[model samples]
Target: ASRRDAAPTGDFHLPGWLDVPSMAVSRSTSRLRGPGPANVSTSGWTSTMHSLRVGILLGCLAFLCGTAGAGTPLLLAGSTVLYQRVLTQPGAAARATPGTAGGRLITALSRLYVYEREDLAGQAWLRVGTDAAGRNLLGWVPARDTLAWNQQLTLALTNPAGRERLILFRDWDALRSVLDAASPPAAGRALVQGIAAGGTDRRAVALEPETYVNLYERFYLLPILEIKDYSTAAGNPVRAVKVASVTLPEARGRTAPGSALADQGSAAEQLQSFKAAIVFVVDSSLSMGPYIDETRVAITHFYERIRTAGLLDKVAFGLVAFRAESANEATNEQLEYVAQVFAAPTQVLNGEDFLTRIAGLREAPVATDYFDEDPYAGVLAALEQPDWKDRFDARHIVLITDAGALDGTVNAPAGTVPVNNRAVPAVDSSTGLNAAAVQREAQRAGVALAVMHLQTPAARQAGNLARATAQYKDLARNAMTQQEAYFPIADGTRDRLRAALDTYAGDVIAQIERSTRGAATPFGPAARAPAEAPADAADDADQRARIQAIVASLGHAMQLAYLGERRQTAAPEVFEAWISDTDLADPGLRTVEVRVLMTRDQLSDLRDLVAQVIDTAQTDLDGANSTAAFYDRLASIAATFERDPEATGRRRAPELAQRDLLLDYLAGLPYKSDVLDLKKSDWTSWGLQRQADFVDRLRKKVLLYSRYYADTFGWVDIAQTDNPRNREAVYPIPLKDLP
Candidate 1:
């Protein structure tokens, strides 16, 4: 039943599992009374009722057994489902049912009949069996939390990384068809993920306490790159897990991904989507022969591997080949640099079209008198090309050059070698953008820029080579959101260089995933399909997207703030995942794709999440990762605020006052909001500024109240600041007395 074709697709319908006879007792296993209820005289009426009940019970059991497999054992779930248990022994420290950090579970048992039992703490305990490594094993489980003679069926899928993906279902026929069609991974197992019925909207699989003995809440994932998204609607949720473990041809390009929520479409469309603009920008000097050929081959290999994995729908390719202009060409200015577009960026994933386009690149028709080519010109041309898509899901630019940008400040590389005065500028050149402008444009356009220096053997010994590497490396960092974005792939060999390119092919997917993942839902990239917003919902959807984008932006900012305060120098994604999936340690975070914009209730929840993150950062600062410094900074700020003389005398900040008013409203104290005073026509009229003004007005109420009772008349103590803390005393202060 692990196959999708084997999964149930229709509405869940049980075949009379609970239908049982209710006959009067003819006999009893214990006590003096017979099988019927005690004190029943065997009268004609009683006999007739018994016959009907017996017949009904028999028919019910027969229906149930028909649906169930023959001789199948079953166990009753204990009172406490998702109860903690150790795989080792009864007294061992408990672990999650799925168990943290292990290979895929081969099989899950539906139920175990208790041949024997022990009573412990008013709960029935029974034994369950599991087979592993060719041996039968028995584990202890609490009995009777859930009771059903029928088995709870599940589909357990695993990725090549041994990460288990399981989905529980009452019935799903679609899943079975998907599984049957999928070709498994080269190494580990592969399984499909599906929507089921559960606490969450989708992720419908229900976890059985007896199966895991580890948890009641269930979570599952499907291999992202391997599976096809079954649904194509604008809002369908597609569950996915990172496929970083899957091997691909090496790549060296840098990747910068945009927000998952900002993507053009819903989760399913986004996952099925690929729109990227990658301009190779290769230096086409005579010395670049082997460099260009090998780079193209490496990329070809990468495409082949991804094609095998069914991920071509997620990528596009472009090319730019350049050469230094001859002395006769200097009249054309930038044209003297001789940079030209080899292939405009387009979706290569649709077919084998990219291979032919890339094969067309060759050495320039003429050679240059100078060592440096107009590398900057080549890069600028790539960014200016019109072939790139406007509404890209992700975008990247790969810069490949062998020589240094022309630097006017430094005398022509040891002279007499005929200085390439058409030097790349530190910033934008008079004719074109320098590294800074290129990077700034990339960042603004959400295009990641990667600089791959195809170095010659002499690159290390020359001062010019060092300068070029330094300049390009800084360019890479500027184009990316991460500090260690450059890959020093020691491109001294063909294999090493190919490996670097392969890194980009894989890392691009990874970086995109990190940037787009939501903070409070299933921890995968969240995106909307590229379809136009419906006319009826255009404004509502747009505003919703804006609010979510803001929340996600703040989430990113909070993580950065924590790292900055702590003086840490690590990739930001580390903390992002921590905040998004906080409960992964206890029970796994619910695996549901949350792509919709937050509603009013969800907005409140997002606020709560913000508060939790802030509070957690303040408390858990003593670890070795320099979180202690972050905590200390927070404490220092708090102390400073507390020590403020103005604060002591109730001269509170407007923001603080506003927060107090909002908190009160959230706590269910809905006084006629002063915010509604300047009533707007509708929510569309209430932009962010209006929302801010509302909070400020509400805050003014708090401040005015504070000044009257505490500062002006001394009606209440300063310590009793927030409203309702001392309601009776506050009321006695009088509306007339209030300032």
Candidate 2:
């Protein structure tokens, strides 16, 4: 280090990587010592004094060398702004110029947008800045000290409590080799253990399992820079993706100078303080009197248990009653209310208060025109009426109904959007929400819906049971749990309904107990591994197990949320490392899930584009006798709709299939579209039925887009601009929901 700092005095040689020429060093040294003493006494003492002065100068140079890349500036190789971005590694410094010193110190895993690239003696250096536009220059950083991140695609890690700790390998081959082993799981365990024990192959592991936490409910994102697809030795497909772990800005600014949870209280105290809000949305027509009476009994008993456990403040209940609406105003009046909010969760201070508030709740005197009722309206009310985010971490709505939800029926006026199938105005419900819309709204509010469907004799006779089951399952589906939390009571017996409610309530209470005892982990003392039921297990056992699993999932989510808010748990800052999407312990379970970051404008554009395709297909396909005529009509329509009709001709695929017709946000996504890639030839090859199927798929996509656009809860203003129009405000949409 001392010799390198001397600036080539008396045949000093620099490292080849530094690429400093001898003449350049000489000129630099000469410039530094301008107009010094010309003559001096040639004595031993003078020589020693000169040597001491040189030593001081070299020491000062070494101090200056602390600035990374303090040498000749490398020539710029290119100036095009790179679409790809990068994250920094530890000790990475952005110098003022390529191979020159003194610039900003970037944090590990901090995102940087590159403006230019330069190579000096086989070392690549990137000129980066603060933003994608390259407006604010941050300076140059060596390519070796950064990780390439192109798509901005990120994965949210599932809870690691039940699963083995994710092993981040140094490269793809290391991960693949483990998966290819005769016993992949055993090999994976051995590799992890070897790394943990500091064996010879320790360098193969970039991060230990314990360094990462379950990012179930936090802003932390693990950006996937690269992805590899491969099959295991057993022919099971697996994906190994390279990810750059980051602790985002949102994770900062919590309690300072200590563990955030420690600042509040002890770990046990913080975990025990988990709160839950459960709202019962009931179908209360004339025939529901007995069920309503039983519901009251179940709640009263559950309240007693909660009070006994001293968790009165931790749990609260609200009620909503929904009935059917008809085209006739008189029918609606007779029904009294489509969805009446008896009590909001906020209004219930205690168990006594909850009961008192809903004392007047009862079944309506009149019945509806059909077996299907406005259950979605009741759910919408539950979601909209309460401040779920501020009040509770575990928010749930238990929908108790005997009949199916009102999706579509013959009795109605025309032109209303059909939910399941066939449009009708009256069935649109008072809230103007469909099943899909209701589910999106619930997600926005972070509320889970659990349906208790009583498949009554009447429902079976009317053939509404099947439709009700499908609709209720869709409504109650929990993404984290990967299953619907819908419970079907085949006999619709009051006693059975009461028993289901008891079990649901008891499971929730058990979760709260486990959480409070610092047993939120999968193998914690309070958490027992579920006993596998026999193949011929009773419906009751199945229902009980399902309820337990759903409640446990909900509890896990709540704990994660609590930890995120209270503890500020963050992902490990690994610059670049390879990790498998599936868990090592159980290959069937996913360790990470994909999400697409979309802006409101982009979603709206996608919705509009899909709607246009639907309109065009509906208008043109009906009149056209052949596929050729349909193609001609589609081309004409595209010319009429697009701003530059001539540009439409240049499109790779005609009309609806044109990529240019979609938003820029949709264009770069790592997904293939059924409609966007269609050519005239492809459409001609597809028979009439297949073509019609394509149109139908677009319509479904349009419906999904509408639901995604309507989701108000998920949009996050990352830029903090306060302006809604700013494109920086994005929502991390689940990839499955993408059209």
Candidate 3:
């Protein structure tokens, strides 16, 4: 019978080359009597023997056919018996012959167990199977919630002879291609291909069927997938791709300093220690409503920006508003108002909230008719808090108002400009020059004073107010200016303010960087080294000798005579007397009141003498002669004061003297014209040299006089003899610090 006949009714057929037919037999039995040996001849007997052999062959063929009917059961039993023998017996004793089909099949099955271990974070397991060609197959598995971008999957194929081959799929596309290539045809031997495909969620799809295989029994490392929000220039929605190992929160943390995991903890601690005490000097007067609205918007934006930058972790802000008097009030009322401090981190002020508050401010009844809109008084009040000095490192008193200063005192006036109107009084009786004194006090306490002037018309009309406002704006905008100087506000001041703030912050960060990572060691005691010279030793001997020679020449050659040719005099007795007499018996002779004693005529005489001395010194110094123009100028100045003590008060004698000394020193230098005529760029090349020479000459003269003063007064001369230091000291002292 054909193999087709042996095949089961539902079984599918193999190709022609693989078909094997089952044997079958037909049976019939009949008894025949055999003749006695006497009846057979020798030839007949031989023929009968041949016939008997043929008959036995025919019988054997019948038995084989019969057995073919029960072939399936016999084959199953034989296979079971062989399997038992191979498993139970020792490997050496039961070894199959080389090149045998059974031996090759056993070797191929054993080789399927050999596989390399994978050490990926999200790996599941390894699967093994066989293709239609009987080739071994392998694949990788993935864990739940895992998304790997551009992942490479590999397979190891081991043959019956124990030979191994590696097959790699570069990505999902490659993996799909490999599976398609290995797929079996419908009408052929079905080879087992082991692969299982599933995922934790709908968003993820495993490219390979073996992605769910769990290599680790109870542990798995989950892969992180990133979902990005992409937008167009107009902020419209755009497409997003799920990227592997790109976490959104982690990215955000990396971009912003305080948002990082490590920084967040520290930032929280810092926030706890941060306490802000802000005094907002808002302008609530009638003229400031519109400006106040805009300011509110700006301030709201500022708050929002701070919050977005994560600065709220270390900041707390407050407010204070001020306004003018009501029309019915007899006296100008300047309201002193404040907001209760909010201690927690809050969202930026909303526009509606700001507008509502501003509107309420406009409608609110006046608290005091005598207050008026005096920003100076409000400034003083804000800065005078008892605990203010200790509470904040960044104390800002922002004054947002129109006009400069006004009197809150009552006065009789209908249409008349009140005595206090637009007048920033230099002195206050009640507060004792309190406004000016407060400015000084704020500066001393290192409290920043920022004045945002909303006096639009006045600020625009007058250059004085504009200049003052500009300075104030600078101070308000720049924290560094607050530390070093004061800046006032004016029109077009926002950019300057922002730039100053940036510069100040940059400076602070730079200082931090330097202190943390500079050549100077931090948190250590002062490093001590042996001095180059003893403390009392004469340093720079040659320079000192030269200075001494110049001083001696100056002392000997110096003369003080009126330009009108009065007898040549020693550096005037009155000047010497003035220097020697410390006690100011005459009120006019006191340093603060010296200007009161001078006459106009004496000033004119002193001016002429100063001019002559400069000319003479120039002539002598130009020839490299032992001359001292610096001393001569100093003497000329002293003589002016001696001759007419009040000359500087009557006019600007000190200014004139400074201008002459600058001009004289310039003229005395070899490159005087070059120094004076230098453009801004030329300063890069010429400034250092000119400064060096000026400093040297000025230092010699200052030292000479300083030494003289020390000797005469019996005081120690601690002044530095360097060029820069001497030039700085040569300028006449300001009136406030003169005595």
Candidate 4:
């Protein structure tokens, strides 16, 4: 028998056993012809050999089956043991076992599963499953603080057959370490940690928690890893995974049960409903030619802008012109009979008319000439009218002029003082018509006066005329020469006028608006519009322009004051005396009290003046700023009179009083070599003296003029003295006590 042909074929077979067969019978044997008895014997021997091989193979198969059957349980037991060992002591596990012949028997396993989700304490939890090889796995552990008490989450586990089953867990942290290892710290609830098969074989894996458990009052992000598996165990490549983030909104607190006081309107709405008014008192003095023209133009521009911007509809405007005298007197005479009245009685001129008026004034004779300067008279006339209060919602007088008040009597000799028939002996003794009276009247009327001086050659020339041209130049120079000469008295007149205008305009407007709170309202937009569009539009435009010009002029005048350049042309003492005497008694002449609301620039000027005074005092012990000294003089006049009546009543009663205080303060200061060395101590005494003198003069003036000037001035006496001596001096005449 051929060794290749004789092989046993039963339940078991061996690799080198081809000669063993009961399975070697071939259909081709008949064709090969049987050998005779010897051949038959050989064949029989082959058969015998085949049978023997089969028998041996059968015995071997039985033994192998028995061995395998016995070892199967052992293998299963070993596997269980290994699993237990790995489970209990994970580090000692191995990847493969020893073979029956002597080497290791290796097996690969892979696993993949969707982690189970659980809700614990308002947070989501997930438990990940193992891969096919049961090697590496992951789980999700939710933050306990983030979860509510009762919550649930779902997870899916997948097998090699592509089948998935849902799993649920109660605690988020109970998942296996393999699953937990896969989760990041930020991941919620359940986490996954991987498992290793053998100690040597490490399988890297990630387990994704499928669902969140009880997620109340919390936000969640999308799941990160949809699928997870081990690279080496499943023969599959591992892929990167991302975890989803969660966010939640802040909670709101309950409001108090009884709170009901809430604002009904927005801040803007409240502000929008507020009402305001502005009035302009324009100077019609001849000197205000180009300026007045410019003012008108500016006003026109202002009106146009305001109308366009829609502010005109809410604001009201009024106009008053000062320094217009009666037409008859020869020197410092009134230009017209109705001198003090405002240009527009009920309303400001429409644009065209205002411009035309300005042009006419510009073309007309120069009214600010030496013979016609009487700003004081103009101010008084304006305040006297009965309809003044009702003409505009606000009242403001802006005086634009070049010189101070002139003698109202035009034909009087230049040197003679005009007699004041209206003066009361107790109040005023030395003067013709009292110029201070006009100031009192203005104060009574609650008028705020602003002065705008327009510089011109004629105006400046007039100043020289008052000093050199008059026959009583020396007398006038001596009597009136003081800070009064230096101060632009004309400018002061205009300032008084402006003050009146401001007070009247501001107060009146406030009153009107207040009074009209529920009065009949103006017509609505639909009703107010009328036919004649061009004419009406032109008229409205013109009115608005005029108002605008007035506003601008006022602003400019304020700017000039701020610059300390409010005085235009300095007038001579003679001119001021002449004007003061003549115009003081004129019905149009009146005193105006102005409370200046200082601008930044004006404040700066004041500071400079103060600094200059300090410097000057240090350099030359005599106070150089006469204007400041004058105020001091005025303040001390009362004290000097009270202490030394006989001395105060001397030739230069007011003047001597002023000079004495100034000298005393200056003499007390310690001399300094450097101009910069004028410290606060150097000026302290003088400053206090100056302040005292000013207050004293102001009080006396207010008291003396208050009665006669009641129509124009409002009086309220205020004393600012702390020393018992000073207080005693101030007490004799209280401001409010005056009639």
The top-ranked prediction according to TM-score is 2
Which is the winner by TM-score between candidate 2 and candidate 4? 2
Instruction: Record all residue pairs in model 2 with backbone atoms less than 3 Å apart, i.e. clashing.
Output: 272-516
The models' CA-based lDDT, in order, is 0.32, 0.56, 0.26, 0.26
Distance (Å) between predicted and true CA of 593, model 3?
A: 21
lDDT of predicted model 2: 0.56
Better of 1 and 3 by lDDT: 1
Query: Best to worst by TM-score, what's the order?
Result: 2, 1, 4, 3
TM-score of each: 0.33, 0.69, 0.26, 0.28
lDDT of 4: 0.26
How high is the lDDT of residue 426 in model 1? 21
Clashes of each: 55, 1, 22, 130
Residue-level error in angstroms, candidate 1, position 41: 80
Candidate whose lDDT is highest = 2
lDDT of 3 at 283: 54
Two-way lDDT contest, 2 vs 3, winner: 2
Worst 10 residues of 2 by lDDT: 38-47
Reference-based TM-score, model 3: 0.26
Per-residue alpha-carbon lDDT of model 4 for 605-715, expressed as tens digits? 222333333344333323332333433433333232222222223234345433444232122111111211323344344443333332333333332322221111111
